[model samples]
Target: MYKKETRGMDIHTFATDGNQEGVLAELEKGIFVDSRNEKGYTPLACAAKSPHASVDLLRLLIDAGANIHAKVGESQRQPLALAACSGSLEKVQVLLDAGADINAESPSGYTALLHIMFRLHDNEMLLPMAEFLVQHGAVMDCESQYRESPLSAAYLRRRWDVVRFLLDAGADPSPLRWSKLLEAVALGSCHDVKELLRVPGALQQRDRFSRTPWLLAAFVGHLDKARLIHAAGIDVNEIGQCGETALMTSASIGNPEMIKWLIGVKVDLELADEFGQTALTQAVQFGHADCVEILLAAGADPSITNEYGDKPITLTTSEEVVRVLVEAGEDIGDVSTEMRRILIGLEGSSTLRVSKSEYQEGCQRRFGSSNPETMDVPFWQEMIRTGIPAYESKSQFGDLYEMTCVWCFNRFGASFTALPDGRYVQIGGEHEDYYDPDFCIYNDVVVFQGDGNFTIYGYPQEVFPPTDFHSATLVGSDIYIIGGLGYHGSRRFGTTPVYRLNCHTWHMEPVTSTGACPGWIYKHKATLSEAGNITIRGGTIAIAQDGVEDHVENNEVFQLDLTCMTWTRFAAEP
Candidate 1:
């Protein structure tokens, strides 16, 4: 073992010292030239990495049958990659000439060129070594496992010269991958961006979220890049995926100069997002007093309200912003505040109340029943049994009282149906706004028996996710649930969403239907006819228009044939 260790170290030492004579002499003795040291450094790898090593030394090791592709250490460090890291063009050339793969990667997926660009920090020989590697057919866009290409790595390392060279060498700056144009805008580099603009459709590139390059400039307050992109034919008032204009983005970031630039460019300050938030509203909500003042001075309407009915003054908590809004002839008080006060006042006020027994008596009077247990059982069952009536829970005392098992009536867009065995079933629903913490889309089946007994059954998320605004029509023993709004991330766009719930076992299963299915519909009516057809009518369907989901009112009637489970759409008669 000791002899083997000594021989390995001798070859490695000779290789590291760049001693061509000693390495050749070792070859004459027929020694193992590919022997690895304790650091897993073979003779060829050591010689390739040594700066003092001549090209002949590398060639001698290669001629001696040393592995040119031999990798060492846990990183699987290749010999050619080590030579490239040394910034020696000749050593890199010797390895490449000796059948070394130019683009061979380590276990981490970094090629020899990527290693040189990423590891070198302002070295004088960086460009020459990079040029040498590139000239030899090194892939400029070969990405690492982290999706970072050679050009992107250089860009991230702030190597502008290398970035320009790589760009000139025809590296593709994919908008979906790491975007050089967006990065230049972020760095506020107009010169670099100007040079990059020569690429066709450079200014028109958008990220995955549909954020334009000009919009990114607005986000970072880079007026120079914004002007560059604008001059290059990019729209200054480009709207993002959420309908947010560049002016609104600048206002939200509290950049007064960016706001001033946007205003000077004649951007539409009144443009609102999907939430109806304008630039002034954005500034006020983020408490940017300076931005608010600038926007108002630029002829922005101070009275503009969002979809939530919140204007600048109503949304702003900043006293300075409020004063600015007031000086601009805006309303002084918040309407929401007055509404909140009214609700608070009602919270303390008392209403004429009745005892539970009196409420039961009133229920007995209404239903003509003598049993107290059966009286005022919150008659949700009776309403579904007959027809919905103008019914309120009140006793003969003319006041309301709480029931033993309080069924919350706060559900909206939920399914409530009467089962065949005299059981009432209530399906999934949400309370209020989807953004609210309490706004939960329930997937539980609330079963109300005829004997005033109720049970809540829950299914797995995969079986029944949070559902709402769908139709639950009873067809035989199975309840066929048609389309509704689920979570945005879980929405299936191309086909209709159908599920079946067995009333007997309460088991839920998804149904995959075919043939011209209604794509993502809600607020629709589903009816089971005697001919075993479920006809659907008058619902809003979510259709992807220009990559954005648009809800269009669908008046066409679609019938689902249960036998084959297919949908057939036909024109609805006026």
Candidate 2:
């Protein structure tokens, strides 16, 4: 060992063990470190192998002027790249600070960040190494032999913070030829993803799959985030790679809230996807009753058949949905043979224009076209009068006031003949304006009576108006009012109290637990399955902490079995 040491450090042990300090010292002392080890690794190879060798050691040998870019025996890894791959951020920093090439190419043509990003799992060290390399003029767009850039690697690993840092340090996220912003949003769902979407030039870019952020969010059921993206004006209905619209994607995922919100914004529910299935078909096929209802209400065509020749009604399991479709089919009266002949005649005629002489005569006779754009006040009043009946039929005020009280009475599934005051009498399901009970009659009406003074059979019942949206659900024979806003005098009440209604007797039960029964949630949707399980979906909990108000979609589906008197989470199969 001593004799070989005198001949400088031999390759035999240095190649196997990578103990380069002794060999490095001997090289600084004018002794040549041999490359003929058992595996033919030189001192440089050994130094690169450990990668934790101090900068002083590297510098001492480099001053003796060892090649800074020397490749290892077989792997051909340079010392700087090896240091990066080993995740020795300190050693990497030292070597780069000592004028080691930041842009040096390895045998595989990987930059330092490329090696670090691909090999090291530590983001803390990798981030600094990445920053240091980019700060010292490292090429951010350098594509690996695998056609991956540093930005792509960061995106694949879902390191949005690292991606942000890289982008800030002049990394071109464009050569990725994909929306790293969408990938970040899809994977991380980070709030900082908003920054990437707002990155000025990012919205116009599409991914390799040709999907925008809005399409990706919709596909992934990130409804709230998708809404934010849509409000940013990136074309909510833009068809993606397979001509799949956001509406189709939302429907496929059974996201009723997203469907309703999209419909509320007037998204074309009739638009078909690549598979030629409309949003309504997708919703029905997936058995999303709520989504089906919303789509139907939004005027989705029930008659349009898919490639399978099945309409939306064929996919429903509920009798109520079948009845709705049957009623709708009836409303579309048949076309007459004479009407068809008249339509065909109009279509085939081309010289049907009224002459200018006829128009002048008609205008003079009608006392119109004087200013061309203006009409007589009485004439305009007639037009307004014509619209009043239609407006009243559809308006909320008309529905509440002028519409026959029978319609309102039927809304609560109540049976009554007539009152002495010439008003329709209701059997039950009535509440005052200030305090209303959450009650539904049969399959017809779900009524929420608000708090106010109400005379029930000429007797006043003390009222409590439901404070929040999720205060009630009528499941089977029971009206389950979970949590709501309570008012005591002028003070506001916020509590989660589970109430049950057996026929007409109202019983209150206090839910004394945490997590399962959270306090005072509004805007919740509750469903009662045929198995008698009550499933509550999303809602907003009314509470603030640390000066911050919090709202949640309440992804947990809870089931309260009346027989067990226990609340168990409903774990549905995805």
lDDT of each: 0.72, 0.53
Model 1: which residue pairs collide? none
Top candidate, metric lDDT = 1
Worst 10 residues of 2 by lDDT: 330-339
lDDT of 2 at 556: 60
lDDT string for model 2 (1-574, tens) is 1122335544334423444565555555766644434444456545554644554555555566566666654555667887777666665666776677888876667877777777764456777777777777888888878778888787555465677787778787675465667766566565756777778876666775576787767766777677668777876678977687889878877888888788877788888876668987787666676777778778888777777665665555443444455445511111121222221221222121334343222211122221111223331122122222212222422232322211111121122211222222112322122322312111111111212111222111122232323334455444565654333232122345565532233322334433345445544545556787566566666565675555555566666665664666645521
lDDT for each residue of candidate 1 in 488-556, tens digit (9 for 90 to 100) = 767777678899988887778899788978789998877777799898887798878788877889879
TM-score of each predicted structure versus truth: 0.35, 0.33
